[model samples]
Target chain A: MSADRLIKLELSKLNVHLPERRPSLREALSSARPQVVARDGSTHAFKREELEFLAGLLPEADRDKLQLPILIALEPKLGRGTARISGEAEVKVVSQVLEKEASAGELLIYRPEVAILRKKLPTTTQYLFLW
Target chain B: MAALAVSPTRMELLKLRQRVGLAQRGHDLLKEKMDALVIEFFEVLRRIQEARMKALEQLSVAHRALSMCFAIVGTLETKQASKETRRELQVEISTRHIMGIAVPAVEVREVERNALVRGYGLHMTSSVLDEASREFERALKLLIELAELEGSAFALARELEKTKRRVNALEYILIPRLKEALKFIMMRLDEMERENFSRLKRIKAMLEERG
Candidate 1:
């Protein structure tokens, strides 16, 4: 196979584990068992502890607005190692966890912060690749 | 004259050189990736070893507890309790990509902890058997987690080794041979052109002298 083709295949496989669509935080919390199906047809469950942490971050009204498995955007343009955390409540919670200053709207996190966020909320957060 | 004769073939040599450079870069990057994967694999393996030991120890403890319960409550009653207990334990398993490999996300429900949803007939029920069942159930959950982790670690390790071999082959053998072939072709092409140019010049001089 050509090098380009191999690289394309590798890049395509990077996000196969991501859910087609994320559930609302409220829906996830209310359900007896909260889980998502991956592209490869496997179920991934959300941890109760991570859900509770998310609950503590947002108001009751915002719970429905906030989505489970908050996307951590990994764009190549942002350089190889950096990632982004979007959404107001998601940013707030992540910022607090990483002990960083909370900015309004989206947050541009470096690689170390991204790693920390992932470590803290492995099930509740997922990496999103943007072209 | 020699320089002019070899000028046309220089372009091919330059192109071949660039290709070799790209291949070398790719090999280096892949080698680095393989090393990183090996490191990650070994780390996971270490964790798995610890988890396996702990889980097996806990399983044995639970089995011992169950045996003691059987002795106290009678064998038939303990067996009956085991049969009556709800074993609808579901694990929500999902795949997470580590590098290129898929690893399972095993999530087990807290089955044996629920007190209100009692199993077995009320008349035949003994708290000792329930305790035994619960202990065994807890151990099972831990064992399942350990199994998933160990399985993933092993799979990742195998993949890492395979990738390392490929990287080594490309770096140490294929790329080098291609470069050598390319160098030989360029040298031969240059020598042929030089000889052709010298022959042409001598013929031109002889014709001029004859004229």
Candidate 2:
């Protein structure tokens, strides 16, 4: 029973670093100090240069559609070395970045592609683990 | 092949099964955490490589600038300028959580100050000295970032190795042993139930014969 309790505690802690609310691209670009509050109440700030780079990647109209700290869903069901980028704007941006045809509302990227995306958008991207 | 210290009962079997389930789930989650740590570690390593190259180059340039100062302003004057200059470089180090582990996140303030802010005295300041200071400041900034990256890589790797060990324990040891024990209990329970039925039948036959 104690082992069960410990496992539950470990499972609960997997996503504590996730932000309670993500800032939009426009908000991050405009603000001098743009940060998100994690579920555990820690602050994660976006680098200004990364923000500027993201702003350049999207058009003005699409700025609001794009969110800060893009969720990279890493699910075991997707098999190893694969992640899904959901949300319409997220799929669009990721597809363009990877030079792949854009899908509607979701896109799956391989490990190397994920590495490239993270390299290009370090502070702007955050990994989300899914069961 | 040590036996589990539990009676061969359905209740014990169920408990063992639940434990195996928990262990399996923990293993998968920890595995995912390990994979993510590897990615994060490699990313840090890539960044560190670039930062190291830039920092090392700038450092060599700074050294060259210092040598030039030594020749132009004389060795003692350059050494004196170095002494007068502010050398305390402070890095903003805060803890950032990577999964359950906390790694340091370091930020550096604007280290490359103008000659006036270098505060080596107005009269003693020279172009060569300022150049050396500026280059060294830039190098210091890059090195600070590099240090943070290296620290994170090591921390992540340590966490990754730890998680991997847990996963292997469950996958290769705990889960399999639990399953084997469960199988042994089930077999023993079945054998006992069969023996009980046979004993009951034998008693019934003797009683009927006596009657």
Candidate 3:
């Protein structure tokens, strides 16, 4: 195959680990079983400890507003080593965990921060690739 | 006859060199990636071995406990208890990406410790069976986590092997062939230019002599 075609194929596979749709945090918390199917037709589960930690971070009312499997955006344009944590509750929880000051809406994190977040919430956090 | 030749030969040589450089860079980076993946894979494998051993041992212990309960509480009653017990345990699962590999998230539900929820009938209920089930449930959770980790480790290992092979091919074969071809072309171009220069000079000398 041509170099261009090979690179395109590699880039296409970058986000095959992500879920088609995410369940809301409330649904994950309430359901006895919570799971999401990946693009590659595999099932992925969330940890209860991470869910509880997220629940503790927000008010009871915000549980429904927040979503499970908080997306950690990995965009090549964000540079080779940076990722973003978006959404109000996600930002708030992540900033608190990393002991960084939380802004209102989104949090831009470096590679180290992303690694730390993944370590802390392995099952509840997923990496999403953005063009 | 006097028209200048563009000589795209030089341009092709430059482009070929650049490609060779890119291929070399890619090979080096991919080798580094494979090394990192191997390190990660072995670490997970070590953890999995430990987890599997512990989980299986715990399961055996639980089975022994249940056997004792059956002897003490009557086999019929014990079997009846297991049937009546609420086995509605659910796990919350999701996927996380590690270096482009998707690994399963296994969050096993905490088995209820409540005596009522334990669901063993009072007639021949032995605390031994409850304890056994609890232990087994805990082991099951740990085993599931280990399974997920092991599965991911295996997948990553396979991908690492494939990447390593590609890197090796580029470094040891494809890039080298391209460079060799480029060198051959360059040598031929230079020899042709030298011959042309000598021929032109000889023709000029002959023409001058004849005039």
Top candidate when judged by lDDT against the true structure? 2
* lDDT tens digits, residue span B182-205, model 2: 899999999999999999999999
lDDT of 1: 0.73
Deviation in angstroms for A28 in model 1?
16
Q: What is the per-residue lDDT of model 3 for residues B82-180, given as tens digits with 9 covering 90 to 100?
A: 888877777787766665676665777775366577766666456777776777777777778787888888788888878878777777776677677
Interface RMSD of each: 5.8, 2.0, 5.7
Runs of candidate 3 exceeding 4 Å displacement: A7-131, B1-8
Q: Judged by TM-score relative to the true structure, which candidate is superior, 1 or 2?
A: 2
lDDT: the better of candidates 1 and 2: 2
Q: Which portions of model 1 miss their true places by more than 4 Å?
A: A1-131, B1-15, B114-118, B204-211
Model 2: per-residue Cα lDDT at residue B3: 57
Locate the minimum summed-lDDT window of 10 residues in model 3 chain B: B1-10
Q: How accurate is candidate 3 locally (lDDT)?
A: 0.73
Model 2 CA deviation exceeding 4 Å by range = A23-32, A48-68, B88-90, B200-211
TM-score of chain A of each: 0.90, 0.92, 0.92
Clashing pairs in 3: A44-B93, A44-B94, A45-B93, A45-B94, A46-B92, A46-B93, A46-B94
Q: What pairs collide in candidate 2?
A: none
Best-performing candidate as measured by TM-score: 2
Poorest 10 consecutive residues by lDDT, candidate 1 chain A: A1-10
Q: What digit string (tens of lDDT, one per residue) describes model 1 on residues B31-94?
A: 5445445545666676788888888888898888888888999888878876776667778877
